[model samples]
Target: MCGTHGDHGRTVPPAGEGLRIVVVGKGGVGKSTLSALLARQLSRRGLGVVAVDADEQRNLAATLGVDLATVESIVPVSEDADYVEEKTGARPGGGASGMLRLNPDTSDLVDRLSVPAPDGVRLVVMGGVLRSGGGCLCPETALIAAAVAGMRLHDDDVVVMDTHAGVEHFGRALARGFDTAIVVVEPTFNAVQVGVESARMAAELGIDTLHLAINRSRSAADVERVLAYVDRLGGFQFCSTTVLPFDEVVLTCEPEVGTLMDGSPLADATVGLADGVLAGNRRPAGSVT
Candidate 1:
Protein backbone atom coordinates (compact mmCIF):
# COMPACT_ATOMS: atom_id res chain seq x y z
CA MET A 1 0.00 0.00 0.00
CA CYS A 2 2.97 2.34 0.53
CA GLY A 3 5.91 3.23 -1.76
CA THR A 4 4.23 5.45 -4.33
CA HIS A 5 7.07 7.55 -5.72
CA GLY A 6 6.52 11.29 -6.20
CA ASP A 7 8.84 14.19 -7.12
CA HIS A 8 11.16 13.89 -4.08
CA GLY A 9 13.81 16.31 -5.28
CA ARG A 10 14.73 19.11 -2.92
CA THR A 11 13.47 22.51 -4.01
CA VAL A 12 14.15 25.83 -2.33
CA PRO A 13 11.06 26.94 -0.43
CA PRO A 14 9.60 29.94 -2.25
CA ALA A 15 9.90 33.44 -0.83
CA GLY A 16 7.24 34.20 1.82
CA GLU A 17 6.11 30.60 1.76
CA GLY A 18 5.32 29.20 5.18
CA LEU A 19 8.23 27.30 6.72
CA ARG A 20 7.74 23.93 8.33
CA ILE A 21 9.45 23.96 11.71
CA VAL A 22 9.14 20.94 13.97
CA VAL A 23 9.66 21.42 17.74
CA VAL A 24 10.85 18.25 19.42
CA GLY A 25 12.25 17.25 22.81
CA LYS A 26 11.36 15.45 26.03
CA GLY A 27 8.09 16.39 27.74
CA GLY A 28 7.97 19.44 30.06
CA VAL A 29 10.58 21.22 27.95
CA GLY A 30 7.96 23.72 26.75
CA LYS A 31 7.67 22.41 23.18
CA SER A 32 4.00 23.33 22.97
CA THR A 33 4.80 26.81 24.25
CA LEU A 34 7.50 27.17 21.65
CA SER A 35 5.08 26.02 18.97
CA ALA A 36 2.44 28.48 20.16
CA LEU A 37 4.99 31.24 20.25
CA LEU A 38 6.08 30.49 16.69
CA ALA A 39 2.53 30.48 15.44
CA ARG A 40 1.73 33.73 17.20
CA GLN A 41 4.82 35.47 15.87
CA LEU A 42 4.31 34.36 12.30
CA SER A 43 0.64 35.18 12.34
CA ARG A 44 1.33 38.64 13.69
CA ARG A 45 3.63 39.19 10.72
CA GLY A 46 0.51 38.64 8.56
CA LEU A 47 1.71 35.25 7.47
CA GLY A 48 -0.78 32.41 7.61
CA VAL A 49 0.75 29.79 9.90
CA VAL A 50 -0.64 26.42 10.89
CA ALA A 51 0.22 24.75 14.17
CA VAL A 52 0.11 20.96 13.94
CA ASP A 53 -0.21 18.89 17.08
CA ALA A 54 1.38 15.59 16.15
CA ASP A 55 1.58 14.71 19.80
CA GLU A 56 -1.21 12.57 21.17
CA GLN A 57 -1.25 14.59 24.39
CA ARG A 58 -3.37 17.20 22.49
CA ASN A 59 -1.87 20.13 24.34
CA LEU A 60 -1.24 22.20 21.20
CA ALA A 61 -4.94 22.90 20.68
CA ALA A 62 -5.39 23.87 24.34
CA THR A 63 -2.26 26.01 24.33
CA LEU A 64 -3.69 27.93 21.39
CA GLY A 65 -7.12 28.00 23.07
CA VAL A 66 -8.69 25.78 20.40
CA ASP A 67 -11.08 23.15 21.75
CA LEU A 68 -10.80 19.91 19.79
CA ALA A 69 -13.20 17.09 20.59
CA THR A 70 -11.61 14.28 18.57
CA VAL A 71 -8.90 13.69 16.01
CA GLU A 72 -11.53 13.99 13.30
CA SER A 73 -12.59 17.27 14.86
CA ILE A 74 -9.33 18.77 13.60
CA VAL A 75 -7.95 16.52 10.87
CA PRO A 76 -9.57 16.86 7.43
CA VAL A 77 -8.34 13.50 6.26
CA SER A 78 -10.61 10.46 5.93
CA GLU A 79 -10.03 8.29 8.96
CA ASP A 80 -10.15 4.58 9.47
CA ALA A 81 -13.54 5.07 11.06
CA ASP A 82 -14.75 6.71 7.89
CA TYR A 83 -13.62 3.65 5.98
CA VAL A 84 -15.60 1.19 8.10
CA GLU A 85 -18.59 1.84 5.83
CA GLU A 86 -16.93 2.28 2.42
CA LYS A 87 -14.83 -0.84 2.75
CA THR A 88 -17.86 -2.81 3.84
CA GLY A 89 -20.27 -0.92 1.55
CA ALA A 90 -22.42 -0.34 4.63
CA ARG A 91 -24.05 2.82 5.90
CA PRO A 92 -22.57 5.00 8.63
CA GLY A 93 -22.84 3.41 12.09
CA GLY A 94 -23.57 0.06 10.47
CA GLY A 95 -21.61 -2.46 12.52
CA ALA A 96 -21.67 -5.98 11.06
CA SER A 97 -22.18 -4.86 7.45
CA GLY A 98 -19.18 -2.45 7.61
CA MET A 99 -16.93 -5.15 9.06
CA LEU A 100 -16.52 -7.01 5.75
CA ARG A 101 -15.58 -4.17 3.39
CA LEU A 102 -12.30 -3.24 1.73
CA ASN A 103 -10.25 -0.30 2.93
CA PRO A 104 -10.57 3.14 1.29
CA ASP A 105 -8.07 4.66 -1.10
CA THR A 106 -4.90 6.00 0.54
CA SER A 107 -5.44 9.33 -1.21
CA ASP A 108 -8.97 9.52 0.16
CA LEU A 109 -7.66 8.69 3.62
CA VAL A 110 -5.16 11.58 3.45
CA ASP A 111 -7.89 13.93 2.26
CA ARG A 112 -10.13 13.30 5.26
CA LEU A 113 -7.43 13.90 7.87
CA SER A 114 -6.95 17.58 7.05
CA VAL A 115 -8.90 19.76 9.51
CA PRO A 116 -8.99 23.54 9.25
CA ALA A 117 -7.72 25.83 11.98
CA PRO A 118 -8.70 29.37 12.83
CA ASP A 119 -6.72 32.19 11.22
CA GLY A 120 -5.12 31.30 7.92
CA VAL A 121 -3.22 28.31 9.28
CA ARG A 122 -4.72 24.80 9.25
CA LEU A 123 -4.47 22.21 12.05
CA VAL A 124 -4.18 18.43 11.53
CA VAL A 125 -4.37 16.40 14.71
CA MET A 126 -2.45 13.12 14.23
CA GLY A 127 -4.20 11.45 17.16
CA GLY A 128 -6.28 8.45 16.13
CA VAL A 129 -6.45 4.62 16.22
CA LEU A 130 -2.95 4.48 14.73
CA ARG A 131 -1.30 6.18 17.70
CA SER A 132 -3.12 3.78 20.01
CA GLY A 133 -1.08 0.65 19.33
CA GLY A 134 2.51 1.89 19.52
CA GLY A 135 3.22 5.39 18.13
CA CYS A 136 4.26 7.26 14.98
CA LEU A 137 6.21 4.25 13.73
CA CYS A 138 3.10 2.57 12.35
CA PRO A 139 1.39 2.72 8.93
CA GLU A 140 -0.82 5.51 10.24
CA THR A 141 2.30 7.51 10.90
CA ALA A 142 3.43 6.97 7.31
CA LEU A 143 0.05 8.18 6.01
CA ILE A 144 0.13 11.32 8.12
CA ALA A 145 3.69 11.99 7.05
CA ALA A 146 2.60 11.80 3.42
CA ALA A 147 -0.31 14.12 4.06
CA VAL A 148 1.92 16.68 5.79
CA ALA A 149 4.42 16.48 2.97
CA GLY A 150 1.65 17.08 0.50
CA MET A 151 0.54 20.13 2.45
CA ARG A 152 4.05 21.55 2.41
CA LEU A 153 3.98 21.48 -1.36
CA HIS A 154 1.52 24.38 -1.19
CA ASP A 155 2.65 27.97 -0.61
CA ASP A 156 1.33 28.34 2.93
CA ASP A 157 3.01 30.85 5.19
CA VAL A 158 4.24 28.29 7.74
CA VAL A 159 3.55 24.87 9.27
CA VAL A 160 4.87 24.40 12.79
CA MET A 161 4.61 20.94 14.29
CA ASP A 162 4.62 20.29 18.03
CA THR A 163 6.02 16.79 18.29
CA HIS A 164 6.04 14.37 21.23
CA ALA A 165 9.04 14.51 23.50
CA GLY A 166 11.96 12.01 23.46
CA VAL A 167 11.91 11.91 19.64
CA GLU A 168 9.59 8.93 19.61
CA HIS A 169 7.86 10.42 16.59
CA PHE A 170 11.10 10.91 14.70
CA GLY A 171 10.37 8.15 12.23
CA ARG A 172 12.59 8.00 9.13
CA ALA A 173 9.93 9.11 6.63
CA LEU A 174 8.28 11.63 8.91
CA ALA A 175 11.53 13.41 9.71
CA ARG A 176 12.24 13.92 6.03
CA GLY A 177 9.25 16.22 5.54
CA PHE A 178 10.41 18.80 8.06
CA ASP A 179 12.48 21.69 6.72
CA THR A 180 14.07 22.22 10.13
CA ALA A 181 13.95 20.26 13.36
CA ILE A 182 14.20 22.60 16.37
CA VAL A 183 15.08 20.67 19.49
CA VAL A 184 13.86 22.50 22.62
CA VAL A 185 15.78 21.84 25.82
CA GLU A 186 16.06 23.13 29.34
CA PRO A 187 19.28 23.66 31.32
CA THR A 188 19.10 20.34 33.09
CA PHE A 189 20.78 16.95 32.82
CA ASN A 190 17.73 15.07 31.57
CA ALA A 191 16.69 17.76 29.05
CA VAL A 192 20.20 18.08 27.73
CA GLN A 193 20.49 14.34 27.43
CA VAL A 194 17.25 14.19 25.46
CA GLY A 195 18.45 17.00 23.21
CA VAL A 196 21.65 15.14 22.47
CA GLU A 197 19.81 11.93 21.79
CA SER A 198 17.25 13.68 19.58
CA ALA A 199 19.93 15.30 17.48
CA ARG A 200 21.66 12.01 16.95
CA MET A 201 18.45 10.29 15.99
CA ALA A 202 17.45 13.05 13.59
CA ALA A 203 20.83 12.95 11.88
CA GLU A 204 20.67 9.18 11.64
CA LEU A 205 17.28 9.46 10.02
CA GLY A 206 18.79 11.84 7.42
CA ILE A 207 17.11 14.96 8.82
CA ASP A 208 20.04 17.21 7.95
CA THR A 209 18.54 20.50 9.10
CA LEU A 210 18.59 20.07 12.88
CA HIS A 211 18.81 23.10 15.20
CA LEU A 212 18.50 23.80 18.94
CA ALA A 213 16.26 26.13 20.91
CA ILE A 214 17.08 26.46 24.62
CA ASN A 215 13.85 27.15 26.51
CA ARG A 216 13.16 28.39 30.05
CA SER A 217 16.60 29.90 30.37
CA ARG A 218 17.13 32.14 33.37
CA SER A 219 19.95 34.16 31.77
CA ALA A 220 22.08 34.54 28.68
CA ALA A 221 24.90 32.69 30.41
CA ASP A 222 22.58 29.73 30.97
CA VAL A 223 21.77 29.59 27.27
CA GLU A 224 25.46 29.65 26.41
CA ARG A 225 26.14 26.83 28.84
CA VAL A 226 23.49 24.66 27.23
CA LEU A 227 24.92 25.39 23.78
CA ALA A 228 28.34 24.39 25.01
CA TYR A 229 26.92 21.12 26.26
CA VAL A 230 25.30 20.43 22.88
CA ASP A 231 28.55 21.24 21.11
CA ARG A 232 30.38 18.81 23.33
CA LEU A 233 27.92 16.10 22.31
CA GLY A 234 28.82 16.79 18.61
CA GLY A 235 25.43 15.87 17.15
CA PHE A 236 23.37 19.09 17.11
CA GLN A 237 23.31 22.04 14.78
CA PHE A 238 23.29 24.84 17.33
CA CYS A 239 21.40 27.93 16.31
CA SER A 240 21.36 31.05 18.47
CA THR A 241 19.69 29.62 21.55
CA THR A 242 16.54 31.56 22.46
CA VAL A 243 16.72 32.39 26.15
CA LEU A 244 13.13 32.20 27.34
CA PRO A 245 13.15 33.89 30.71
CA PHE A 246 11.34 32.22 33.61
CA ASP A 247 8.40 34.60 33.42
CA GLU A 248 5.49 34.59 35.80
CA VAL A 249 3.27 35.58 32.88
CA VAL A 250 3.96 32.29 31.18
CA LEU A 251 3.32 30.52 34.48
CA THR A 252 -0.05 32.17 35.09
CA CYS A 253 -1.11 31.59 31.51
CA GLU A 254 -1.39 27.93 32.39
CA PRO A 255 -2.80 25.57 29.69
CA GLU A 256 -4.78 28.28 27.86
CA VAL A 257 -2.10 30.89 27.45
CA GLY A 258 -2.49 31.90 23.83
CA THR A 259 -1.21 35.36 24.63
CA LEU A 260 2.32 34.82 23.38
CA MET A 261 1.38 37.13 20.52
CA ASP A 262 0.91 40.07 22.90
CA GLY A 263 4.51 41.37 22.73
CA SER A 264 5.67 39.50 25.80
CA PRO A 265 9.27 38.48 26.35
CA LEU A 266 8.49 34.91 25.36
CA ALA A 267 6.83 36.23 22.22
CA ASP A 268 9.89 38.30 21.38
CA ALA A 269 12.19 35.31 21.75
CA THR A 270 9.95 33.19 19.55
CA VAL A 271 9.95 35.90 16.88
CA GLY A 272 13.71 35.85 16.87
CA LEU A 273 13.66 32.08 16.50
CA ALA A 274 11.19 32.36 13.61
CA ASP A 275 13.35 34.97 11.93
CA GLY A 276 16.39 32.73 12.20
CA VAL A 277 14.40 29.87 10.74
CA LEU A 278 13.10 31.94 7.81
CA ALA A 279 16.56 33.32 7.09
CA GLY A 280 17.94 29.79 6.80
CA ASN A 281 20.59 30.62 9.38
CA ARG A 282 19.68 27.45 11.19
CA ARG A 283 22.97 26.17 12.61
CA PRO A 284 24.15 22.86 11.26
CA ALA A 285 24.29 19.95 13.66
CA GLY A 286 27.69 20.06 15.39
CA SER A 287 28.21 23.63 14.10
CA VAL A 288 28.62 25.18 17.56
CA THR A 289 32.24 26.03 16.85
Candidate 2:
Protein backbone atom coordinates (compact mmCIF):
# COMPACT_ATOMS: atom_id res chain seq x y z
CA MET A 1 0.00 0.00 0.00
CA CYS A 2 1.48 3.29 -1.11
CA GLY A 3 0.80 6.07 1.40
CA THR A 4 -2.00 7.67 -0.60
CA HIS A 5 -2.29 11.44 -0.01
CA GLY A 6 -4.65 13.11 -2.43
CA ASP A 7 -7.18 15.87 -1.76
CA HIS A 8 -8.90 13.54 0.70
CA GLY A 9 -5.66 13.32 2.72
CA ARG A 10 -3.63 10.20 3.68
CA THR A 11 -5.18 6.80 3.20
CA VAL A 12 -4.01 3.85 5.29
CA PRO A 13 -0.27 4.20 5.78
CA PRO A 14 1.51 1.34 3.99
CA ALA A 15 1.81 -1.89 5.92
CA GLY A 16 5.40 -2.67 6.98
CA GLU A 17 6.36 0.95 6.42
CA GLY A 18 9.65 0.92 8.34
CA LEU A 19 8.92 4.08 10.24
CA ARG A 20 10.38 4.53 13.73
CA ILE A 21 9.89 8.21 14.42
CA VAL A 22 11.77 9.67 17.38
CA VAL A 23 10.92 13.09 18.81
CA VAL A 24 13.79 14.71 20.69
CA GLY A 25 15.38 18.05 21.62
CA LYS A 26 16.41 20.00 24.68
CA GLY A 27 14.38 19.69 27.83
CA GLY A 28 11.07 21.60 27.74
CA VAL A 29 11.22 21.67 23.94
CA GLY A 30 7.91 19.79 23.67
CA LYS A 31 9.26 16.39 22.60
CA SER A 32 6.39 14.65 24.37
CA THR A 33 3.90 17.14 22.99
CA LEU A 34 5.01 16.55 19.43
CA SER A 35 5.05 12.78 19.90
CA ALA A 36 1.56 12.84 21.35
CA LEU A 37 0.25 15.06 18.58
CA LEU A 38 1.78 12.89 15.89
CA ALA A 39 0.36 9.75 17.48
CA ARG A 40 -3.02 11.44 17.76
CA GLN A 41 -2.95 12.37 14.09
CA LEU A 42 -1.90 8.93 12.94
CA SER A 43 -4.55 7.24 15.09
CA ARG A 44 -7.24 9.67 13.95
CA ARG A 45 -6.43 8.75 10.36
CA GLY A 46 -7.32 5.12 11.15
CA LEU A 47 -3.76 3.90 10.99
CA GLY A 48 -1.88 1.67 13.43
CA VAL A 49 0.10 4.02 15.66
CA VAL A 50 2.27 3.02 18.63
CA ALA A 51 3.26 5.84 20.94
CA VAL A 52 6.36 4.94 22.95
CA ASP A 53 7.08 6.94 26.05
CA ALA A 54 10.86 6.51 26.17
CA ASP A 55 11.46 9.62 28.15
CA GLU A 56 12.17 9.25 31.83
CA GLN A 57 9.50 11.80 32.69
CA ARG A 58 6.93 9.57 30.94
CA ASN A 59 5.03 12.58 29.69
CA LEU A 60 3.49 11.23 26.45
CA ALA A 61 0.69 9.33 28.24
CA ALA A 62 -0.80 12.53 29.61
CA THR A 63 -0.42 14.40 26.34
CA LEU A 64 -2.13 11.54 24.49
CA GLY A 65 -5.06 11.75 26.94
CA VAL A 66 -4.48 8.38 28.61
CA ASP A 67 -6.17 7.88 31.97
CA LEU A 68 -4.05 8.31 35.09
CA ALA A 69 -4.53 4.73 36.17
CA THR A 70 -3.40 3.36 32.84
CA VAL A 71 -0.46 5.72 32.70
CA GLU A 72 0.60 4.78 36.21
CA SER A 73 0.40 1.09 35.36
CA ILE A 74 3.11 1.41 32.69
CA VAL A 75 6.61 0.34 33.71
CA PRO A 76 9.54 0.23 31.33
CA VAL A 77 10.42 -3.26 30.25
CA SER A 78 13.96 -2.62 31.42
CA GLU A 79 12.69 -2.04 34.93
CA ASP A 80 10.84 -5.32 35.20
CA ALA A 81 13.40 -7.32 37.12
CA ASP A 82 11.79 -10.68 36.56
CA TYR A 83 11.20 -10.24 32.85
CA VAL A 84 14.64 -8.79 32.30
CA GLU A 85 16.18 -11.70 34.10
CA GLU A 86 14.08 -14.23 32.22
CA LYS A 87 14.95 -12.77 28.85
CA THR A 88 18.59 -11.80 29.32
CA GLY A 89 19.52 -14.24 32.10
CA ALA A 90 20.94 -11.26 33.98
CA ARG A 91 19.68 -10.10 37.31
CA PRO A 92 19.29 -6.42 38.18
CA GLY A 93 22.21 -4.93 40.06
CA GLY A 94 20.98 -1.62 41.39
CA GLY A 95 21.34 0.02 37.98
CA ALA A 96 21.44 -1.57 34.50
CA SER A 97 25.04 -2.66 35.12
CA GLY A 98 24.77 -6.42 34.74
CA MET A 99 25.41 -9.05 32.05
CA LEU A 100 22.99 -9.33 29.14
CA ARG A 101 21.84 -11.41 26.24
CA LEU A 102 22.75 -9.46 23.16
CA ASN A 103 19.93 -10.94 21.11
CA PRO A 104 17.01 -11.56 23.43
CA ASP A 105 13.63 -12.52 22.08
CA THR A 106 11.39 -9.44 22.17
CA SER A 107 8.70 -10.60 19.75
CA ASP A 108 5.92 -10.86 22.29
CA LEU A 109 7.11 -8.33 24.85
CA VAL A 110 5.73 -5.14 23.32
CA ASP A 111 2.29 -6.53 22.56
CA ARG A 112 2.03 -8.20 25.93
CA LEU A 113 3.13 -5.14 27.92
CA SER A 114 1.91 -2.12 25.96
CA VAL A 115 -0.88 -0.13 27.56
CA PRO A 116 -4.11 0.01 25.60
CA ALA A 117 -4.74 3.60 24.61
CA PRO A 118 -7.52 5.78 23.27
CA ASP A 119 -8.49 5.38 19.63
CA GLY A 120 -6.29 2.80 17.93
CA VAL A 121 -3.07 3.82 19.64
CA ARG A 122 -0.88 1.69 21.92
CA LEU A 123 1.59 3.01 24.48
CA VAL A 124 5.00 1.56 25.36
CA VAL A 125 6.95 3.03 28.21
CA MET A 126 10.67 2.35 27.65
CA GLY A 127 12.03 3.86 30.81
CA GLY A 128 15.67 4.90 31.11
CA VAL A 129 18.53 2.66 32.22
CA LEU A 130 20.24 3.79 35.36
CA ARG A 131 23.66 2.73 34.11
CA SER A 132 26.71 3.68 36.07
CA GLY A 133 28.73 4.41 32.97
CA GLY A 134 28.19 6.94 30.21
CA GLY A 135 27.64 4.13 27.73
CA CYS A 136 26.98 1.12 29.83
CA LEU A 137 26.69 -2.32 28.30
CA CYS A 138 24.09 -3.80 30.65
CA PRO A 139 21.20 -6.21 30.46
CA GLU A 140 18.45 -3.55 30.54
CA THR A 141 20.02 -1.42 27.85
CA ALA A 142 20.78 -4.47 25.77
CA LEU A 143 17.16 -5.62 26.01
CA ILE A 144 15.82 -2.28 24.85
CA ALA A 145 18.40 -2.12 22.12
CA ALA A 146 17.59 -5.65 21.07
CA ALA A 147 13.87 -5.03 21.16
CA VAL A 148 14.11 -1.93 18.97
CA ALA A 149 16.57 -3.40 16.52
CA GLY A 150 14.90 -6.79 16.17
CA MET A 151 11.19 -6.17 16.63
CA ARG A 152 8.83 -5.79 13.68
CA LEU A 153 5.50 -4.01 13.57
CA HIS A 154 2.37 -4.51 11.51
CA ASP A 155 2.30 -2.97 8.08
CA ASP A 156 1.44 0.76 8.04
CA ASP A 157 2.14 1.05 11.72
CA VAL A 158 4.10 4.11 12.87
CA VAL A 159 6.19 4.14 16.04
CA VAL A 160 6.41 7.56 17.68
CA MET A 161 9.03 7.60 20.43
CA ASP A 162 9.14 10.39 22.98
CA THR A 163 12.82 10.50 23.95
CA HIS A 164 14.51 11.88 27.00
CA ALA A 165 15.75 15.46 26.80
CA GLY A 166 18.81 15.96 24.59
CA VAL A 167 20.54 13.47 22.30
CA GLU A 168 22.06 11.27 24.97
CA HIS A 169 19.46 8.61 24.24
CA PHE A 170 20.40 8.60 20.58
CA GLY A 171 23.55 6.61 21.23
CA ARG A 172 21.48 3.56 22.03
CA ALA A 173 20.64 1.22 19.15
CA LEU A 174 16.97 1.24 20.10
CA ALA A 175 16.61 4.76 18.74
CA ARG A 176 18.75 4.20 15.66
CA GLY A 177 16.05 2.20 13.83
CA PHE A 178 14.05 5.38 13.41
CA ASP A 179 14.07 6.20 9.72
CA THR A 180 12.49 9.57 10.43
CA ALA A 181 13.24 11.82 13.39
CA ILE A 182 11.49 14.97 14.50
CA VAL A 183 13.46 17.43 16.62
CA VAL A 184 11.23 19.85 18.51
CA VAL A 185 12.67 23.24 19.31
CA GLU A 186 11.60 26.54 20.83
CA PRO A 187 12.71 30.06 19.87
CA THR A 188 15.76 30.18 22.05
CA PHE A 189 19.49 29.95 21.45
CA ASN A 190 19.83 26.86 23.60
CA ALA A 191 16.90 25.13 21.94
CA VAL A 192 18.25 25.86 18.49
CA GLN A 193 21.65 24.60 19.51
CA VAL A 194 20.10 21.39 20.68
CA GLY A 195 18.18 21.11 17.44
CA VAL A 196 21.32 21.53 15.39
CA GLU A 197 23.15 18.94 17.42
CA SER A 198 20.20 16.60 17.27
CA ALA A 199 19.90 16.93 13.52
CA ARG A 200 23.63 16.60 13.01
CA MET A 201 23.81 13.44 15.06
CA ALA A 202 20.78 11.97 13.33
CA ALA A 203 22.40 12.60 9.99
CA GLU A 204 25.53 10.87 11.22
CA LEU A 205 23.40 7.90 12.24
CA GLY A 206 22.30 7.59 8.58
CA ILE A 207 18.74 8.69 9.31
CA ASP A 208 17.66 10.43 6.11
CA THR A 209 14.45 11.97 7.38
CA LEU A 210 15.09 14.80 9.80
CA HIS A 211 12.53 17.51 10.53
CA LEU A 212 12.61 20.49 12.86
CA ALA A 213 9.37 21.61 14.40
CA ILE A 214 9.28 24.96 16.19
CA ASN A 215 6.99 24.78 19.16
CA ARG A 216 5.32 27.71 20.90
CA SER A 217 5.81 30.06 17.99
CA ARG A 218 3.74 33.19 18.45
CA SER A 219 3.44 34.09 14.77
CA ALA A 220 4.90 33.57 11.30
CA ALA A 221 7.70 35.97 12.13
CA ASP A 222 8.67 33.92 15.13
CA VAL A 223 8.69 30.86 12.94
CA GLU A 224 11.01 32.59 10.51
CA ARG A 225 13.26 33.61 13.37
CA VAL A 226 13.52 29.97 14.42
CA LEU A 227 14.20 28.95 10.83
CA ALA A 228 16.95 31.51 10.63
CA TYR A 229 18.45 30.03 13.75
CA VAL A 230 18.49 26.61 12.15
CA ASP A 231 20.21 27.97 9.10
CA ARG A 232 22.80 29.66 11.27
CA LEU A 233 23.51 26.46 13.15
CA GLY A 234 25.24 25.82 9.96
CA GLY A 235 25.05 22.51 8.09
CA PHE A 236 22.54 19.69 7.90
CA GLN A 237 19.78 18.46 5.62
CA PHE A 238 16.53 19.31 7.35
CA CYS A 239 13.79 17.50 5.42
CA SER A 240 10.93 19.68 6.66
CA THR A 241 10.03 22.41 9.13
CA THR A 242 6.79 23.41 10.88
CA VAL A 243 5.74 25.97 13.41
CA LEU A 244 3.11 25.14 16.03
CA PRO A 245 1.74 28.26 17.63
CA PHE A 246 1.52 28.35 21.38
CA ASP A 247 -1.87 27.34 22.66
CA GLU A 248 -2.83 28.80 25.97
CA VAL A 249 -5.43 26.10 26.38
CA VAL A 250 -2.72 23.46 26.53
CA LEU A 251 -1.04 25.07 29.49
CA THR A 252 -3.47 23.39 31.82
CA CYS A 253 -2.66 19.90 30.54
CA GLU A 254 -3.53 17.27 33.09
CA PRO A 255 -3.56 13.50 32.78
CA GLU A 256 -7.32 13.52 33.31
CA VAL A 257 -8.11 16.75 31.45
CA GLY A 258 -7.39 15.22 28.00
CA THR A 259 -5.58 16.56 24.94
CA LEU A 260 -5.27 16.12 21.15
CA MET A 261 -9.00 15.64 20.80
CA ASP A 262 -11.57 17.14 18.37
CA GLY A 263 -12.03 20.32 20.40
CA SER A 264 -8.33 20.91 20.87
CA PRO A 265 -6.23 23.30 18.77
CA LEU A 266 -3.14 21.19 19.24
CA ALA A 267 -4.84 18.28 17.58
CA ASP A 268 -5.85 20.37 14.58
CA ALA A 269 -2.30 21.56 14.00
CA THR A 270 -0.85 18.08 14.36
CA VAL A 271 -3.27 16.84 11.72
CA GLY A 272 -1.54 19.04 9.15
CA LEU A 273 1.84 17.88 10.37
CA ALA A 274 0.83 14.26 10.05
CA ASP A 275 0.27 14.74 6.33
CA GLY A 276 3.73 16.15 5.80
CA VAL A 277 5.30 13.45 7.94
CA LEU A 278 3.82 10.60 5.92
CA ALA A 279 4.71 12.39 2.71
CA GLY A 280 8.38 12.52 3.71
CA ASN A 281 8.40 8.91 4.80
CA ARG A 282 10.51 7.16 2.14
CA ARG A 283 10.51 3.61 3.50
CA PRO A 284 7.64 1.12 3.72
CA ALA A 285 6.09 0.11 7.03
CA GLY A 286 7.64 -2.95 8.71
CA SER A 287 10.47 -2.82 6.19
CA VAL A 288 13.00 -3.19 8.96
CA THR A 289 12.71 -6.92 8.65
Q: Model 1 Cα displacement at 56 (Å)? A: 0.9
Cα lDDT of candidate 1 equals 0.61
- Measured by lDDT, the strongest candidate is 2
Q: What C-alpha lDDT does candidate 2 achieve relative to the native structure?
A: 0.70
- For each of the candidates, the C-alpha root-mean-square deviation to the true structure, in angstroms, is 6.4, 6.1
Each prediction's whole-model lDDT (CA): 0.61, 0.70
How close to the true structure is residue 264 of candidate 2, measured as C-alpha lDDT? 71
Give per-candidate clash totals: 23, 13
> Per-residue lDDT tens digits of candidate 2, residues 86-118?
878786543445556768888777687788777
Off by over 4 Å in 2: 1-17, 94-99, 130-134, 255-257, 281-289
